[model samples]
Target chain A: MTMFTRSDKVSETGGGAKPPARDDTPAPAEAKRPQATAQPLSHTAPPPPPKAAASTVSVISKALKITGQLESTEDIQIDGMVDGDVRGVSVTVGGDAKIKGTVYGEEVKLSGTVDGKIEAQRVVLTSTAHMSGDVVHQNIKIEAGAFINGHCRPDFGKPESKALPPPHKPAAAPPEQKRDAVVGAP
Target chain B: MSALSLSSLVKPPRRDDAEELPVSHLGRALTVRGVLDTEGEIRVHGKVLGRINADCLVLDTGGLVEGDIVARDVRVSGRLNGRIFALHVTLDSSADITGRVFHHTLTMAKGARVEGRMPWRPLNYFETLEQLPETRQ
Candidate 1:
């Protein structure tokens, strides 16, 4: 009797009810109505401008200088100087780029100079690339004219226990670990 | 306007005026924490948690900025929780600002929601401003 009346009210109000599973949970359903009404009151007010800025490919142009950290869920193309760490999905360091901190990404391509470390799944050092720190990558490509003064290790995403040993060698050694993986077939 | 005032507002003294500075874009999914000093234009579609010094700054519709902004021209269509010191300021319809805007010229759209004061300073005020005034309010 009273149950039928309450359900009819719920349906007629907005028809937004979840089909009650057992018909025995009338108290909880009634409680949801107050919250639903509260929503409209706030919705009528100025809406919060869409939250944080959109995440698209961020481009740091040649004239810009960032002195702090930069984090992105998308790609980043840097043509400027960054003093702090940069974490992105795909980081592309352009010809005149200079990064003083660590760079973490899925794909890191360098054509400029990086003073810190690079940890990525795939790393590409172009002809003009000048890297002075260590690079930890799963698959890496170093062009003929690229200048790398640091250790290049193929240990990205590997468990820490097995990642022991720096494999430090002479500057002439050409990232044998990753070359071995290529021959072993990644 | 006096010749002194016109020169101050018409053009800001920037390094390498003959060079065409490229535009930098910070996409929506990016979050930058630190000082970004640039000579060119910067479009922020992402969140910036630190101070920004740029020639021109555009905060797109979905962006949220939380620090002081020092720029020549500032256009906001997003949310800003910090102060702005600029020669020219334009607030779009979707702008939701909480801090003060110190500018020489300000144009605010009808639907913009501003909570703090919009103080208008002379053109020379921006040119001579070496540092932003400390936040007292």
Candidate 2:
């Protein structure tokens, strides 16, 4: 009998036996509530001025003499003297580099002198390089005339670009005609 | 307090039993309280008032950090007002840093503003020659 009365009251209030409507207002859905996500929030403020975009930046290391650490996120060329640590994504030590500190990078190309450690994904020592430190790289390449006095353990399985000859250029003139012209002109 | 007995009362745990546990949020956020040594990338989107040490650090656009940062690769596209020590560093066009920056490779975009010293400058014939004309006059 009480259950029947409760059902009568529920039917009198609303169609379902859930809850009586208050002020006849529709409640918000629970799933439609705000929730936080992993994405960062965006502000509705005015946008700032546009800035320049630098896809590639190069450092030509020449006669620069550095006493402290040197680092970068792009390609680097070391043709100077560095007293402290050096690091980059891609590092190229010219024949004139006289680095006395450790080197860290993704890929390192050496043609200079280093007295400290060389750690990278891959390392390449050219004929002119005179290294006197330990090397820690997944891949290593030593040229024929390269001089290295460092410990080497080549893993040979790393994602790094190797040294290759510059791209060849096509002949501007016909080979036979150029040869004939050279033979006649001289 | 009464006299304590060594054998009757339980002693503190031994050093061997205590593990060398790291803080869960060590390398996350702009935590300036402890060392932020990481083997992965760290992005700073807020302010840091103290020292920061990491493997690689990337400051996204609109990020503002103020402290000392030490890392292997440090790239900034925001504002920094502190010292930076890294193996390499890149200041994008949106960067506005004011402090000393020490690195092996240092690059700044066209619109980037930096007030610090560059430790090394490799040979750039064009840049060198460009300065020659001004110095000669």
Give the candidate number with the greatest lDDT: 1
| A68 Cα displacement, candidate 2 (Å) | 1.5
Candidate 1 matches the true fold with a TM-score of 0.71
Clashes of each: 6, 19
Q: Give me the TM-scores for chain A across all models, comma-separated.
A: 0.58, 0.52
- Candidates' C-alpha lDDT: 0.80, 0.57
lDDT of 1 by residue, A43-147 (tens): 111112233535478999988899899999999999998999999999999999999999999999999999999999999999999999999999999999999
- Alpha-carbon runs more than 4 Å astray in model 2: A1-55, A155-186, B1-137
lDDT (Cα, 0-100) at B91 in candidate 1:
83
Candidate 1 docks at the CAPRI level of acceptable
Question: Which candidate leads in DockQ?
Answer: 1
Q: What local lDDT score does residue B85 receive in model 1, on the 0 to 100 scale?
A: 86
Q: For model 2 chain B, where is the 10-residue window of minimal lDDT?
A: B1-10
Cα lDDT of model 2 by residue, B1-137, tens digit: 11111121112223332222111111112222223333333455543455554444676566566776755557788788887765457677689889877654565666888887655523232124224442232
Judged by TM-score, which candidate is best? 1
